[model samples]
Target chain A: MQNAEKKCAVKKCAMEKSSVTEKVFMSLTGLFLCLFLVVHLGGNLLLFKQDGGAAFNAYSHFMETSWIIRVIEIFLLLFFLTHIFMAIKLTIKNKQARPVSYAVNKASENSSWFSRNMEITGGVIFIFLCVHLYNFMFSQRFFHHYPSMYAAVRTVFQNPWYVLFYVICLSWVGFHLIHGVQSSFQSLGLRHPIFTPWIKKLGVLFAALIFLGFLSLPVYFFFSRTSRRNVQSAISHQLKIENGFKRGASQ
Target chain B: MKFTLKVWRQKNAQEQGSFVTYEVFGISEDMSFLEMLDVLNEDLTLKGEEPVAFAHDCREGICGTCGLFINGRAHGPLTGTTTCQLHIRHFKDGETITIEPWRAKAFPVIKDLVVDRSAFDRILQAGGFVSVNVGSAPEANGILVPKKNADEAFDTAACIGCGACVAACKNASAILFVSAKVSHLSLLPQGKPERRTRVLNMVKTMDEEGFGNCTNTGACEVECPKGITLASIARLRREYCKAKIKG
Candidate 1:
């Protein structure tokens, strides 16, 4: 019998595909988020220096006044929202894929616990974004229009419980960023031989600086009693000034 | 050594399951992991307790039949070693071990620790073979292959088709495994003619098999029993790009 011809010249999608294609999409989106982070951190660090927060806030106000910023702000929201949603979706896909349990629980013996549990860390950050926005964004963006903007800001930070909440949320963000910063490079095809070591170090340093800088503010407000002390001093100083004014008026 | 093995017991692909702990008594420290399991199975057979199921063959680490998540690790605690080659010496006398099937979407559980890795074979059928005239085995050594090409091809060829990479991957990506196979054939003169078509087809097959994406975490290489390097993944990328650009 004559053998059938090698009729099919090329193998098409009829066969199974590799996992690379979806990963590439995830990697590309992850890289875009990384770029957004650098910009976001730069904006937030504006609060680092003296009178920095007010200047930054006014700058944000200035941004709101600009048409370009309006466009970029929309893009920023899309970026964060898309990244977070994709992360959740990807995690589900990952979890569903594994089919077996090992006879020996030996793999985690060598790797870092942080790397093993990145999804949990990332989930915590997702919850944190909600709380952060509830107090900060809801107040500044939505609640500010009604009244008592300063009181909202002060009371949120001034109350010990609220201060504690902020601290916990920021810490979660810190953990998320730590895993994200390192893993993002791998996603982006940045596995250069000589550059990888340096990339890891840079990732660690960036994650640490961002975490520490954000953490310092809430902790300072919580511990110092600075706002309460200033109020007491202001009351005494006001009493003296009022007495002087009364005497002068009487004379 | 008297130890408790907390093995995952699933009756079939359709059923949900949990860990079933069994006591394996008087295991020799020198016996390979599979041998230790053999002792336990022998006991279960005499006692008529539906024998615990597991997959293994070619006790010598060459065949890739032995694969499982051992205590949260692919294979056991040993790096660059297959389960069949893992000796009991790695664990202490009274250690309790957790054993389960390779956890990934592409590899479905057949029964207990036996997973259906036929997805891997499907990936192979895609773009895995070089397009050449049939049965006309080209002149032996007709095409001159460079020494470096031969060496690199051999390195890629060293893969034993093990599913450890899938087990180790957080995203359950088969990039390392696919890339190794792709690179092995693509490196030499005999396989060069169909390189582009091979990558496209193989990659497509990989996705069709329901495998997740590679996060490029390099965990697969670190845990690879054959030491299939992540360089293979890079090579795969380079090949895929070349194929996309040219073909």
Candidate 2:
């Protein structure tokens, strides 16, 4: 009996460590992903330059070729995967914790709707991310569907359906971040009486900025006549140059 | 005043429960929520029906014994008040109040409007006490505790183990209760000796009791009758990290 009790104690300690550790890791990875969003939004701002895609294309080229970026990309992928995995795992346990549902839950009376429905918002963002990566990242690196990143953006956003989808997804991202940023800090135990309220407000402000910043790009490309004309002419000019080079090589 | 009450009824833990509507009349607006229930029970008993088996001890709010998930909010619509302290004036004359026991896997319903909250006692047994004995009472100024720590500890120690936080949480997480216990004890000198082991063991037992992990929704904080802040949870995390590192 003594030996069995000792083994049970060991098992309990390990289980306790992992459960809390899982949450700590979730916080760390979530904060890292938030940082990635800041950097990504900053880089994408280059698309707004009036130079007809030259600066944006150059930025994309450097991003594609840099070794440092490659390493960061690997970490980014890992963070995304781990955050998603932990979310699903935690959500399942949360559901089981309340086997019987409340007959009349006025949850909104106590907490914000976004705070309660993080899984729904997160799942929506994940679905958007899959489509988004396929549209830009995969197409540029693997498919070579467009000559330049800006060209791909121009073509894709021209379709009203894609623009609508992008706008809706960006809104979901805003909802996710509104709760996510401050919640991450709380999970990591970085809270203060005065600073916590400020952190929550700042989180909402940051989420709004991200939404508007990302929203401007697709909206600009879709509606601005100048950008539309410029992209069309730029694509044709690039095609002509490529054909000329092909004929010269044949001779 | 007359009102409709939809109360949950169950014979035993194994039996499934359902809402039983009871029309209660002549209920005064000044009566406490539990007193109103008592009136309903008095009527039920006179009619040779099984009286609603609700739990209560001290009519005062401090005991934390009287809990009911009334009208979707824990302990009724009022904030920072237990059911025993909640007067019926808050409700409309013809209001249909829905009262149910705290719902969680760890807190199984024993009967109508009562759950086995011994999970809380078991968690407390894990490490909620200081085992060391200092035999005699010391001088008043012996420990020299800081005012802020003492106040915060006192605030956290006010937790009544009501399990209202659990009922209010969407995930039915008991982290608020556990964290409150941890914060109060860890803040004092007597509790410092077993801090590391206490946090680990209590958290283990909490998880074993099948409570959900906190999702930082702030629901538990909002619904806690003691007004325990989320900072206690943050402190718990900080303490857990320190313990793990030191270990």
Candidate 3:
């Protein structure tokens, strides 16, 4: 039998692929998602306008109708899927590289807790996405006469459990973003002594903004609904006492 | 000072390893970490037991041959120092220091606290040199080199090929080591001719050697004996991207 030839040869050698291929993919897709978050936040913030759901409903309707937005949404979904896939692949590969674990791993000292637990934070965000899609996208796709986007959001946030869940998930998103934004730049070979510090600072600020912005929606809805209910009950109680006193006086 | 040590012992690559504890007495606080080990080995030799095998070429820090995972840190608790340069003074008396081999699939344990680092050599072989022909030495100022470039290249060239970076890395990635080589050569004019090919082949070899990918955690920079910065890895990425685009 003839001996097998080397798979890579001088004549048209298959390009040398590094394990960092997945890392690069994850970084780019992750940054794309970050941009998507900013656009998403801008749209979601319309729920706060008190103009009754008209503006938010109109915005949601426009987003649904525009072909360009539909295309962008598809790209957004693709980026999310790719980022998740690459993250899992790289994580598993990294684990296998060190089979026999360190006897006494002081790994936490070497890096930040968030940087080390990116996979856990990512997993939390993934679970949040599933619930979010089910609540919002499911209504948009399935219900022919769907409620206004504002009503749908308010209804979801009215549940204390759901609001709490959202707050928790948004916190994890902040954790993931804090490390991920700077990490993407590092992975992309854009590190510079002068600019890296600024980039890191900017990354932290950006993550904080996302956390606070998203958390505000659920928190605001929850508190506003509860306060309105409280005011209504107090007014009704006062009316009951007045009605009772008037009936007694007449008798 | 008296201290206890828990050193990892494996007869060969095929066997599983475990820690073996030993006690040493009357060691001076000023003795280097390796000297303490030598004292322990001497005692074991006198007792007719096989001496613990470890790697150390230059007792001073520069040779990069010596490496140990002391007390969970790569080159002991002291930052920016090699195992050979780490003094017993940094360690307290009666403390039990755990010494282990560089634990990575790419760096298999050869024998007690020693790992086969030939994977590094193979990576170097793949593309760690300039293509200049051997002949009479070129004139000192034949080629004008920018001072800033020369300084940066020198800083990058200081990487001693110690596997501490791999040991310290969460992923056991060799990106730092390969990046050092790539940055040092690509910055110089003599290495300009084959910079693209050099990065391609070296990275390819690094991947093939069963080393993991860098996650940019920056542990390698913190644990590096030579204080090699993460900038080299950044340059490696830039070089790789440029090469891929050119291709």
**Total residue pair clashes for candidate 2:** 0
**Model 1 Cα lDDT, one tens digit per residue, A34-89:** 67666766765665456625766765566547888779878777877767767677
Query: How high is the lDDT of residue B21 in model 1?
Result: 85
- Return the lDDT, model 2, position B125: 96
Give me the candidate number with maximum DockQ: 3
On TM-score, who's better, 1 or 2? 2
TM-score of chain A of each: 0.73, 0.84, 0.92
The model with the greatest TM-score is 3
Q: Model 3: clashing residue pairs? A: none
TM-score for each model: 0.81, 0.92, 0.95
**Shift of residue A28 alpha carbon in model 1, Å:** 3.2
DockQ of each: 0.37, 0.50, 0.55
Ranking by TM-score: 3, 2, 1
lDDT at A2, model 3: 20
